[model samples]
Target: MPGFTLHPFTLLTASTVFMILPVTVQPAITTPINAALHAVAGPSDATDRYRALVRRLADNDPRWEVQTAAWSALISDVPTAVTDFLSPGGGYEKARARASQNASRNALVISRTISTTTATTSPIVHLTAIRASYGTLAEKDRYVRTGLKEAQDLDAKHSPVEQARQQAQQDRDYVADIALHGSGAWVRAAAQRAIQKSTDNDIQEFFKYSWASAAGCDLQAFRMNLVEQDLAYRHRLAQLIVLAQQAQHAYEQASEAAKAKAAAEARLAWSTAADTAAATQASWLANQQLAAAQAQSWQQVHDFAVTASTQQDWPTIADNAAGTSGSWSDEVAWAQSQAAEWTAVYESAKASADALPGANPTVSPSPTA
Candidate 1:
């Protein structure tokens, strides 16, 4: 009964007082909030200071909560900025245009950095930074296109010597492939022979454009050697042909002698002579074929060298020459053996033919006489 009773008007007035008190205290609450905002979003010059502060906080801050909050604030704007820059038709185009217009200084700096740091770091890092500074992916792509265009233009402006160098490199690779792997053993051999005979100048100049090193060996020597080897093989072929002709002549003589011999013993001698001559003739034919193959191989190598020289493809000349050295020696040995074998056959045939009655066989008077 002693407690006071509240009226509706009294209750409403009490609620109003509570609301007025909050209004009066609002400034006190807002002061700290405003101060916090100002600190986080400082003046324009604050960017560098803020970055330094963030790094310091991350590196040396003792409080984990403070460090975490600093990191969060630092990265909070990254996603939004990235989205605005990357989204199609976003305001990135203006930034990209500005970047392009102002990129000269940045480009110079980047170039210098690249040149100086090339030995210490990968070039990709500089390239990536350069691309990023252009502001947007589309802008970076344009930059790349422009760079490629300039490079192509430069290549187009290349002097004849440069063009020749490129051609020489290509030619060298081609000749090397053939010399090392050609189907013809003799051609391969010829290539090797040319290499051994290369001149100093040829080696020095030709190797410049080649992928392979020549250790001061002449690449042009291969072609020249091929030509010389071809001549030698041709000479050998000519000799073989003459031997074949002589063997054929012996065969004819033996045939005639066999037909004229009436005595059984003389007939046997004539028959034996004819057989020897036939074998010799067969051997001569084989040698002629071998000689032709060898000649063809050498000729092929020579022709390749000539073509390469005409094109100024020193690499090819060099490669061909170097590739054929071993094979050339083998070819020479084989040729010598073949020559010896044929010579032996020819001598045996000649001896047998000579033992037969001279062109005139003294036929004993016919048995009827």
Candidate 2:
């Protein structure tokens, strides 16, 4: 009674109610009930039925609600039946019988739950679908692995090769940039050809040949330019040396002319001084002789005056003394004037001869050729 109270109808109650009902009506009621139960329960194949039930449970499917309600009602009877069979008042033999019955009933309830929740599917169809899906995934994985390996191999092979190609392209661009703007027609044409070459290899070869040719031309041009510069420099140096030697020779000739002119001027100055000195000396000697004659005339006049004064002849003494005194005074004045004039000339001539170059009388004068 205690366990049965939880359910709306017990198994005993249902049996009793059926027994009370007439046999003719029993089939009608039982038939519809069995049909309803079958509708709620699913197909017989366990795996496909389970997959269907899980699909119904997902996505808020309405089938899951009906199946859940039915499962609840079915399992509600199990706990009550088990509780009543295992109650404490039973003896050992009865307990053993009840336990076995309870176990059987529990197993039946579980079996009914599984059967009602599942739908039927053929084993062959289920296996085929599974194999197709799995095969697709496996094949895709195999393809992905193979593609990744090939990609890795290609990258490893071409990395350095691509880098070298890029470097070569850069070098070609540098050369082309210069040559395209260069002065020479051939170099520029070569640069254009290098640019138009189809492959990196061809382009590199073109650049190589062009550079070699340009270098040779540049070397020849440089040599010609250097030679021209060197020759011009040498010619200029020789001309400067000739001009310097001519200038030096002219300077030496001019210096000798200046020395000869200076020596001639000195000789002329000495000769002029020597002639003046000789004239001054001759004039001084003549003046000295005239002074001696004047002095003798004065002495003769003084003796005549003394002889006349002793004879007492006043007139003759006055006349002779006055005439002689006048004559002597005039002569003395003339001698003094000539002596001063000659002395000045002699002193000036001696000074001029002393100041001239090489005018020392002890050093004989050099003959001027």
Candidate 3:
């Protein structure tokens, strides 16, 4: 009968004790939170520590479980603090802003590095082009100078502009010609740089036109020298022509003068020779006449004297004839007297002829009748 009795008080007390023990006061979760904070250093360490804390908190609190989910999603691939996490319409708008700023900063740094590399390498390429262009220009300049000097040394004739312009043109053409011929990569690069660097339209246009003009690289230097040479040759030809004319004129004048002088000498010589021949003829004629007259006079005297000698008885006749005959001379003595008189007359005539006007011995005698 003692085993059959039921106790409601004992059953109520057992249920109450079970409920109270299950719902008792828990220790603070601050200890694990402190541990997680202390472990934070870098992103990797922070991520590990945060994950562990999330698991611990998930054991007790529903809010902790929710926070853990959010943190897990935030730091999964992106290592970050829970305080710096981002979500739409969340209370971490500032945290999101900070994270975006950090990303932008990193991007800017990478961009600067790339820009520096390009700037440095680009100049080197440009420099190489410039060096090539310089070599081409220098070679062209040297060739031009050689041609110019040769022309100068040889005294080649040319126009004034051609002579001076060749030198200036060589300098200008070297750059321009190289650009036109595309002789060097540097030339194109330099031109581009100049255009890019300069803001002025004048400078840009100048380079463009200059380069275009130099493209041909012809033999302008030789042509210029040739022009000068042509001018000099013309001058020399003119001088020769003038000298020939002068010589011809002088020869003509001299020939005329010589002819006149010869004519005058002939005239004088003919007149002198004729006068001498006439004087000689006149003297010989006079001597013959005088001798004949003297012979006649002597014959008359001799005949009369002979007649008186035969008639001696007539003394008066004999005396008269003798006196007349005594005055007469011999033929030889009379001829001598006539010759002396003619000689004096001929000498006077020769002196008078010599003093006559227009009597030049150097000229020849003129025509006579």
Indicate which candidate wins on TM-score.
2
Predicted structure 1, TM vs. truth: 0.22
- Looking at model 2, which ten-residue stretch has the lowest summed lDDT? 13-22
Candidate 1 weakest ten by summed lDDT? 14-23
Taken over the whole model, the C-alpha lDDT of each candidate is 0.35, 0.34, 0.31
Model number with the top lDDT: 1
Model 2 residue pairs with clashes? 41-116, 43-118, 43-119, 43-120, 49-119
Off by over 4 Å in 3: 1-256, 310-369
Superposed Cα RMSD, model 1? 45.9
Distance from true location, Cα of 342 in model 2, Å: 2.7
lDDT of candidate 1 over 171-228, digit per residue (tens) = 4344445446442333233334334444433323333322222211121222223222
RMSD of 3: 77.0
Better of 2 and 3 by lDDT: 2
lDDT of candidate 3 over 157-214, digit per residue (tens): 4222111112222223322332332211333434444344443432333233323222
